[model samples]
Target chain A: MYKYDTYDQAMVDARVAEFRDQVHRRLDGSLPEDKFRPLRLMNGLYLQLHAYMLRVAVPYGTLSSAQMRVLGDIADKYDRGYGHFTTRQNIQYNWIKLEDAPDILADLAKVEMHAIQTSGNCIRNISSDQYAGAAADELVDPRPYAELLRQWSSFHPEFSYLPRKFKIAVIASATDRAAMRLHDIGIEIVKNDKGEIGAAFYVGGGMGRTPMIAPCINAFVPLDQLVTYSEACLRVYNRYGRRDNKYKARIKILVHELGKKEYTRQVEAEFAHLLTQGIEPPLAELERIKAQFADPAFESGLTDSVDRSDPDFALWVDRNTAAHRVPGYAIVTISLKPVGGIPGDASADQIRLMADLAKEYAFDELRVTHAQNIVLAHVKKADLHALWTRLDEAGLSTANLDTIGDIIACPGLDYCSLANARSIPVAQKISERFAGREGELGEIKLKISGCINACGHHHAGHIGILGVDRKGVENYQLLLGGSEGADTSLGQITGPGFDEDGIVGAIETATGVYLANKEGEERFLDTYRRIGMAPFKEAIYG
Target chain B: MVEAQIRFRDDEPVGDPAVTADSFGDQTNASAVRIEPGDDARALLPHLDRIRLVEVNFPGFGDGRGYSAARILREAGYAGELRAVGDVAVDQLNALRRCGFDAFAPEVPMNPADAERAFATWPDVYQPTTDGRAPIWKLRHG
Candidate 1:
């Protein structure tokens, strides 16, 4: 975790006082609504359909247990006893009073957190693979670079107020767990023939009203030139992105309209200017940042010898575990998707317990997966049973990781002002319907976004459900084969929109088509690829 | 009414103040305040004028009508007190400075120290936008 130095501290302290004054002005009718709107928005306070909503950045979904506890306290004190985690890895408080927002930001800053640039048409919270440092498969941990980018993009003068919000995600592995391909800018750390680590850049990929699979702009941008290349990409978008219609404002639209070749040409032109100015990052700086991400000391002389016969332990190990690069350790996922419960909402007490577990059984670190679940990376295999029992007691031990019940849902009409339908109930219904399958529906991605903004990133799911209001009635449009990865593809709508019950039935039919055609242990996404959507399309429309 | 402050003309300005904006210069009772817009900014060059301030304007919130003008003034080496004026508020002050405004004349009254304090809340910042100060990351690691 990056701590603020004197300059960093000064900036935050100044920003808080500035916002505090702004709040006072607004309350006193000095700064009119028209004048105060942008000010509030820049601070991550929004006047949504209901009361004001405050979004706090959970940078790369990394939270200290202490930070999580503070967030819990904020929710309890300033809002309803719940806060919603967003697809962008932010948390939103739905019922914030216009007056209390400054206090909330003050609280967050005490723990080195603030919502600045979390909203507004500025660089948003930079995200990366949750398991960056701890992932066994990673060639290099991407956090130090993410932290550098976070520092650079925070309060940047030139790129603030872009055409629309800009997002960037980085991952170190070939397997894109961070969904890098579906971001405005995706940087995957790769090695060269000389074995020097660098970034493979993808531009214009996003899931919003317009869905785009990012195209490779730079095959391998040297680590030294990462900042320069990034600046070039932003310059291209800031210079050319459309400002006429807000809906058509994202850089993806610009990239789509200009065509990939033309966009690349523009970025190359801009990047050349930086090279001419000799503005690339110093090699030493890159080395220094990389050094901060060094792997933690792993325990040697350990082996996986936990008893597997206990049904509870077996079920947990089987469902909620992932392969680690380490021999004696495993990546343990604590599912927030308890059967018939809200998908990603966890009680504050549960947060503290998980934090304690991370400190004890696992390394004193936790990662919030893009799947809206938490991962206790590097948990020694032997400690799995005790961790499972404690987790079971806390009600966090749901053995449905990546199953149909592990649904990712947005705070639809229930919380978000942008949503047309209530996604929570819909997600609940789908999870309950597939609850009986327990073992059959293995490792499927089911995501629901309440509106076209796709905050839930439904377009990236293996089975995507989008809720819309059709003539004042809530209707869901189901799409299949969408993925957020290096091999990213947008899910295509299978058939007509379905009503509340009808959408669940449609998913049931689609899964049935998969079960009939699958060739043993094939994940839903793999099955969709092996047997094309043609079969599922037929099954659903029939 | 206290003093007949002689505002610096484009031709009579001195070395830059290291920061300056139109709003600040316009509102200041300081005689050294310099006001220049359009091509007239170049004329301020030869005077070595004792000008220590400049004022920029925001025509409208959505319209970034004044940002380029402020940057151009900053580029011309007229580093003085940079201020933003007209339709500006506390929200725009941070970005206003990042784009080169050192001070702002909000439509409403405000304490300068409190305004200065507001800029400190966000330690991490992106974008190369700033009035004249180096970014925090650069300052720390530099």
Candidate 2:
């Protein structure tokens, strides 16, 4: 975790004071709602369906034990004893009061966190692989670059008020755990033929009403020029991205309207000019950020052994833990999705417990996965049984990771003002329907979004369900073959939409088709790709 | 009676020079000109030296096209007065200043005390913009 220096602290403190004054002005009726709305949104405050919701940025989804404790404190003291971790690796407190917002921001600032740029038409919270440092296949820990980008994008003068919201994701691993290809700007850290590490830029990939798989605009941008390249990309979008239609204002639409070649040409021309200006930070700055992410000391001869005598513990070890780059260490995922429960909702008590566990067992660091789960990235294999026991006590030890029971869902009509249909209830029902069928399902990634904004990332799910409004009634459309990995592809919608119950049944039918046709150890996504959507479509429609 | 709209030039209160809106046909000859959010700032670059004050209209604060225009003018080496007219608020003062707007002619006259406090909100910034502050990264590493 990057510790805040005096400069960083001053910036956040000033922002909190500024927001306090803005809130005071808004309350006094001096600043009208029209003028106040954008200010509040830029600070991560939103007027949701029931009340004010404040989305706090968990930068690149990494959290210190102290930061986690502060979040738990905020939830208990201000909100309704729980917080919802969002798909963007942020946490939203639904029951926030307009008056208490400044206080909440102040508390977050104390722990080197803020809700800055979490909302509005600005570069949002930059995300990266949750297992960035611990993953065995990672090329480099991407958080250093992510943190540098976070600094560069915060309150950026030129690109703050873009035509629409922009999101960036950085990933260094061979497999994409952060949905890199689904972001406005996806940066993959790659080594060039000369063995120098650089970034591979993918522009315009996003998921919404119109889902697009971002194509590679620039193959390899040198590490020193990453910020400059990103500036060029954003400059083009800010100047040319459509503003007449709010829905089509995203960079993806701009890239689509102007062919990818033309878009790339514009970006290249801007990049050339920006390079001449010498805009990128000095190389020492990169080294300074990189030093912050230095690996924690590991014991020389720790055993890579776990007690698998207990079948339940063994199942959890196999399902919830991932291989760590360092021997004797494991990446432990604490599943927030329990069967029949809401996805990504963690209680205040559970949060505190997770924080304490991270401090005690995992070197005081934790990560929030885009899949809506928490991870202790540096857990020792020897401590698995004890950690599992403690996690099981808190109801956090679900053996479902990428299983059908682990569903990714958004806070749809239940809490969101923009939602046309309910998503959590549907996710709960599907998770319940698929309980105890984890092994048989064979790695099914089911995602549900309440509306076409695709906050739930339904477009990237192998089994995607989109909630829609059909003349006053709730309906769902099923999509197949979407995956957000190294082989990124958007799901295609099958025939007609289904009612709530019909959609659950449709998922069951589709999963059943995969189960029947899958050959040898093939995942749901692999099987679907091999056979195409015909079998699944026939089962759902016919 | 409309309150005399306050204007600041280079962080100091300045007298409002009578700047009239010029028609598109006569814009090149006007010493003072008003540009709407929709107007291209690039078109005025050629006549920037003659123009004493450029008022960029922000119809709504949420519509940030004017910010880009102000930046484009400053980047194009326009040292003349760049005033952000209409829908300006205390919260946006620093951002407007960083984007190279030295003057603000907000629709509502801002309380001078509040505006002063807002301008002084952050003594330093992390990134280098048209604001001319050496980026904190450079300051730290240099």
Candidate 3:
């Protein structure tokens, strides 16, 4: 994990004081709500339905054990003793007081954390593959570049207010674990024929009322010009992107409207102009950042096997653990979605327990996955059983990763002011309905969002459900065949909308179709893609 | 009724009436131009020699296209008094200043002390824009 230097510390400290004054003005009524909304939102404070929601950025999903403990402490001190991890690898506390916001920010500053750029129309918290450093199949770690961009975009004078919110994702593997294509700007670190490492840029992808898979604007940019290229991409969008309508304001719409070639030409021109201005940070800065991500010490001559004596333990090992770069180690994903519970909510105790486990079992580190799960990235295979026991005792051990039970849902009508329906209940019912049978079902990414904002990432799920208001009652429209991985595709709606209970039943019926028609080892996504939406639609509709 | 202006340039801000981008080319004597949210700042490049002041209008602080407009003119070698006009908030002062905005005239007048504090908010910055200030990275690794 990256530690904050003096410069980094100073930046966050300044932001806290700045926001503190803003909050003061707002409370004193010097700044009206309409005027203060963007200022508050930039610091990740949102006025939810019942209360204020403060989103804290967990940059590139990386966290130290100490940082995790502080987050838990903040939840206990300022919020309602719980925090909801979001789809963007950030955490949100639903009950934040306006007066306490400055204090909360000051506390986060102590740990090199703050809510800066978590919301509002600015370059948001940069996301990357959760298993960046520890993954077995990565060309290089992507977090250093992510950090560099994090600095570059922090309080950026020009991009402070974009036409709309912008998102950027980075990945180093061919396997798109970070949903590279479905971002405003997606950078894939790739090697050329000559074996030189560079970045392939993808601009204009997002999933909202309009879902677009970003197109490749530049095939390969030199490693040193990464920031410059990104500046170019953003400059074009800021200059020409539509602002008349909020809905069509994302960079994706501009890219879609302008066509790829024209957009690329404009970016290249900007890149050329910026190159002369010396906008790119020196190579020294990136190297300094990369050194912080050096691999953790791995003990030599260790066993690679975990005892499968208990079927439950074996099931957990099969589902939650991923292969590590070092032998005899595993990347353990602690599932937050307990059956019949909120998708991403972890109590303060559970959060502290996970932090302790990271310090004890892993390498004093944890990561928040885009799927709203916590990962102990370097857990030794030998420590699996003991770790599992502790987590199980704490009710943190859920053996459902990417299964139907491991549903990703938003804080819907229960919390969000933008929500049209309640997503927590939908996720709970679906998770409960397929609790024991998920093993047979194989892999199914069930995602639900309460509204078209897609904060729940419904469009990227294997079985997506979007809640809408019909007249006055809540109705869910089911969609299928969506995947956020390398083969990224938006889920398509399957005919008519269903009532709350009917949607869950509809999902059951659709999965039944998959089971009956599935080949030997095809996942729900694979089966859905091969067979198309006909069978699922016929089953779901009828 | 609030005409308070904060100027950073050594030269006095020209008081000439500003013309729109469409009429800037037509008015041979026009020394100042006003850019709206949608107008391109590059349109004044050819007439930079005579142009003494450029005002970038930000009708709302949330619409940040003015920041880009200011930078484009500055980067294009327009060395005039770049005044950022309209709905400017105190919190936006540092960013506005860093984007090569040497002067400001908020539609709603700001507290001068707060404005000065906002100007000095960041001890350093992360990127080298048209502002001519060395970014923190350069200072660290120069």
Better of 1 and 3 by TM-score: 3
Q: State in Å the error of residue A203, model 3.
A: 0.4
Q: Give the total clashing residue pairs for model 2.
A: 0
Per-residue lDDT tens digits for candidate 3, residues A1-542, read 79988988999999999999989999998989998999889999999999999999999999998889999999999998999998899999999999999999999999899999999999999999999999999999989989999999999999989999999999999988998999999999999999988899999999989999999988899889999999999999999999999999999999999999999999999999999888999888899889999988889888898899999999999999999989899999999989898988999999999999999999899999999999999999999999999999999889999899999999999999999999999999998999899789999998999999998888999999999999999999999989999999999999989999999999989889999999989998999989999888777765
lDDT head-to-head 2 vs 3, winner: 3
Candidate with top TM-score is 3
Q: Write the per-residue lDDT of candidate 1 for residues B9-119, one digit (tens) a residue.
A: 344433433233333334333434434222234344443245565555444654343554455456556666556655565455556666676556655555566555655
Task: State the TM-score of candidate 3 restricted to chain B.
Answer: 0.94
Candidate 1, superposed: residue stretches over 4 Å from native: A275-283, B1-59, B63-87, B101-132
Model 3 DockQ (Cα-based): 0.89
Query: Which residue runs of candidate 3 sit more than 4 Å off their true CA positions?
Result: B1-4
lDDT tens digits by residue: candidate 1, A1-542: 55555666676766777788889988998778887876677788988778999988887777766677788788888987877666677778888998898889899889778988788887888888877776777887888778777766776665665778889997888878888988899988899899888899999988889898888888898888888798789867866787779899888999999999999998997688656644454667556666755666888888977789889789989999987777788889999898888878877677778878888877677777778888887789989999999999999888998788988898889877788988999999998888868688787889999999998788989999999999999999999998886678889888779998999999999888888988977988899999887998788885
lDDT of 3 by residue, B44-125 (tens): 8889999988888889889999999888888888887888899897889899988898888998888899999999899789
Error of 1 at A229 (Å): 2.1
- Interface RMSD for candidates 1 onward, in order: 4.5, 1.5, 0.7
